[model samples]
Target: MCAYQEAGGTDMKTKNQSPRPALPRTPMTVERGVALIEALVALLIMAFGMVALAGIQSTMRRGSDQALQRGEALRLAQGEMETLRDYSVLSAEAAASGPAGTRAYAGVVSAAASSAGGNTDFSVTRSVADWADPVVGQEQQQAGLREVRVRVQWQDRAGNEQFVMLDSFIARADPALGASLGLPASTSATRRPAERSVSIPVAAKDLGNGTSVFVPSPTATVAWVFNNMTGVITGRCTVAMGTLNSSLTAADVAGCSNNTVGYLLSGVVKFSSAARPDPAQPGGTAWPLDVGIVNSTLNGAISAPVHQCFDDAPTSAANTMAFVSFNCFVEPNNGTPRIWSGRLELSGLNLGGGADAKKVCRYSADYDGNGSVSNSEHPENYNAVSGSLSRQNFLVINATASCPAGAAINPENGVFVNNSTVQQQPR
Candidate 1:
């Protein structure tokens, strides 16, 4: 009984031990939580990579669309150029007209729409102009060259504007063909014999530094002649000035006095007739005249003499009014002169009512003979020169004229003249 009782006490003690406190539940480890967090971060990174790849693909597609649009614009421009070439070759009149100006064509369809086998939206523009071949020896217009330009414009996939252009040249078939179109038979055929003469008095103000302004008096006269039978015209002019009163005071002139020196002033004189034809004139023709410098002298001494002449020749048969450029110059003894040299350009001298004219001239001087015109060589430093004249000066000449039949000059017959004077300043 004692042994059985002891066994029962041992079992009760084991049971009362509370099953060893369940091993404290092992307390959940931090390492397992860390592994789960790392998996979630990897999934987030993969999602970002997929999004970036999708964006790259979209950009590539846009680039391809842009390229396709540009190619289509170029093709359209080329096609228009070919069409113009064919039309120009088919008609001599069309080629001679040279587009008359800029012509615009309507837009077709969008590039994206056209790519999908639909219509295309592209605009085209064309322009034609007369192209003169640059002659080597002379400054004269060469007939029969034409320039053609074509432009193509369109929009890209991104709605950005795009454009392409093409250029081409066309020439006359033959010299005889040009002649039939009212052009000169040859370069020599346009030359005519000089047949008239004139003399005019001129007054000039020496601005100093190789520059001067010519002021024509009412006494100035132009003697000209026109031969209707041969369509030949000619004229000669002379401007003489004995002495010019200085614009500055005597004390000022003496303080800035200089030695008498020679100079040459050169430029072009152009003449254009009115668009309306003369009533008495046999043919309803608009004539233009260009006379070059024949001879210019200073104190009875000839400087550089240039002999060139140009006459009115119509670009188109129905077109009236002609354009010509004549080189000219003058020399004067202004009593007190210094070394001077420069260039002159004159335009917009019309025989009729027309106002589009321009002139540009520049002059510089080496007063000390230092081989270059510097700031110290300016004429403003001299008291004799009232107006400020520096190393360069530009002047614009505006002159127009009207003449009737039997008048001393008639621009319709390609008749005109230039009278100029040169002077020296004390500075």
Candidate 2:
């Protein structure tokens, strides 16, 4: 049979073919497919790891940049605070005073580059406000106390808003030491002149008898100016008496009877010294003019003492005038009585001269003699004046009467002095 097979014989089923050499073993095709799958999976895992690492790196870089920006912001904020503090100190020293109520150094400063690339811009703003010491008495409210605030703003790299703020309290320097050291020569040389002025309405209350009381009008205005170089202070004030309740009619006023019926106030105020000094010396460092009053009907005037005058020297300009007191009495004998008393508070002291000079004054008056002041008795007033001097000049006045209540000026008329009104004018 083998010979037949080798010879290609036709014995169909009996011939044994050489077993076909086992079909070449097929080369383990399943194993080859599995190896390829494993290789693909390993590649996929490596790619995923690389991607995750990149994400982490990006996050770390962002975090680092944010930290840097935050640090820079803080630094800039501190720098701005220092700059403001320096300016305030220098200004206070130069002026020899603390800031008034609330004064802004200026508008927002120009934007500054905070980063080396100039991509980040920052702005600084500063404001100064009067700070009263709670521990101290009201008498020391304006002494050695101020609040300063500085704010810095900018945008971060991510286009997010960012800001930093610094707050501090500034105290007035010792007067003796400050004056001895003085300000820098350059600053002193650059000092500008100041103008002062005020306007106030006049009010009066009837105290009966032939006497009446006078005070600042319910609506009053005041202003002041200071000259750093000459150390002179110029001030002006205005009072309105149109609404005064007086017994004098248009005829009496026209006849000039108001002059004798009304009283005038005159007193000298010295800056850099105590109010109402024992001896009342002249030629002081700063001199305030005597407050004088005149009635439209009268040609003569009377003198009076100033009530509640404040001298803010230790913590402010050596010659600064803080507040003024004015009180007076008048007797027209027209069967009317009048009384008036009031005070003016001067704030926001500035160096330059302008309408702003009168912008920071507050006037208060007592109209009913209740010993309490009300908003109704206080009115906004304005004044305009121009002058340049180195000293502070202002007026403080008060008045009193010598007549008893219910006393009749004329017994025959049976129309004794009853309703009294005090009139005021600006000078």
Candidate 3:
């Protein structure tokens, strides 16, 4: 080994040793970018989480805002309803506060911004209507009621419109509401149900027998006449021989006083013509009017039914809208004994829908206590608590003070036809 070392080769194994046989070439430890891949994946997952969190946050914010807005709208509606509750006074159509102040019975109003600045955000409106509800309260009472509707509207953050409403009924606040009647709703006693109009046709001035409007059976303490003549076939309930017939009489309309006046003569009136106004005649003896009666009944008992036509017609005759109808009922009907007629109970519908609905003196059936049909509805049965209306002026009879001869006002059954040879018909 020493001699070889002196040679030119110089022991390649000891000198170079081929770099220790190249260490088998470690294979260069190639990397497939796994760390970078892991980093990218982690970044993507983090981005997804951030996006989810952001969405959740936005949804929560919107939900919270919506809840808040709804609460505010509810509060506004409640406040308005409470204000109406405190009105106390009832029947605002007549005497709500004695003066011109319209607090409770301010009538219905259009949607007006509650905020004086006209902030389109919130608006408030009220609807006041006259109603006679018998079963509204506990048990039964003749309550002059008014329905009040309060509405509050708003827009949510999402630009969606939202609203709230409050509806309820209130009674009359007349100083003598509970005082005058004594027995609650017993003051204006009426028959269980109104008699439907008869189909028979009676002559214009025929005669029949009856007592008071209520006591038409069993002959009571009063005497009245009727128009149930022989030629007038449909007895019981009667209709006119022709449409627009003046001094018309049908079967035993309620009863009649003497040979002229009749009461409770309601039946289906098959109009000869469609009962339209005759513009050629301003105010004739019997002007035709498109009148219809809607007496809503449930289980054979008469409850107050609001007529659509009456509600839609103008309260004032001067309105240019063309139609006019008013609900009419007699106050103090059973007591006080109105010799002619007393104050009337009235309601309003469609009072102001475009035209200025006004109450004019020139009416078709309205009477002003002069036994004349001017301000009152004669032969009208709008009062669910009273008998069919008595005619005025042309056959307008008296409500109290003994029917001509001498008779006490009886609410029970009776046919007050004494022996009158002039207009006596088979008692």
Q: How badly does each model clash, as a count of residue pairs? A: 8, 53, 33
**Model 1, range 1-427, lDDT digits (tens) per residue?**
3534454566744655755555555656745588778889998999999999999988998777767767777777777666544432223343455565322111111122122211347777777666544543221113234577777777766778877788887443322222244533444412322331111111223334222232222232321121222211222223333222233223323322232221222222222234422313313332232222322222343333232222223334355433222212222323333222222222222322346332221223432222333432322222211111211222222222222222222233443211111111101
- lDDT scores of the candidates, listed in order: 0.35, 0.36, 0.36
lDDT of 3 by residue, 327-376 (tens): 22212122322112222222232223333221111112211112222222
lDDT per residue for candidate 2 within 80-158, as digits (tens), equals 6655444332232334454553222331233344334245666656666666555432322223356777676777667
lDDT of 3 at 369: 18
Tell me each candidate's TM-score.
0.30, 0.32, 0.35
Error of 1 at 147 (Å): 3.1
Model 1 clash tally, residue pairs: 8
**By lDDT: ranked, best first:** 3, 2, 1
The C-alpha RMSD in Å for every predicted model, in order, reads 21.7, 21.9, 21.0
TM-score for candidate 3: 0.35
Compared with the true structure, model 1 gives a TM-score of: 0.30
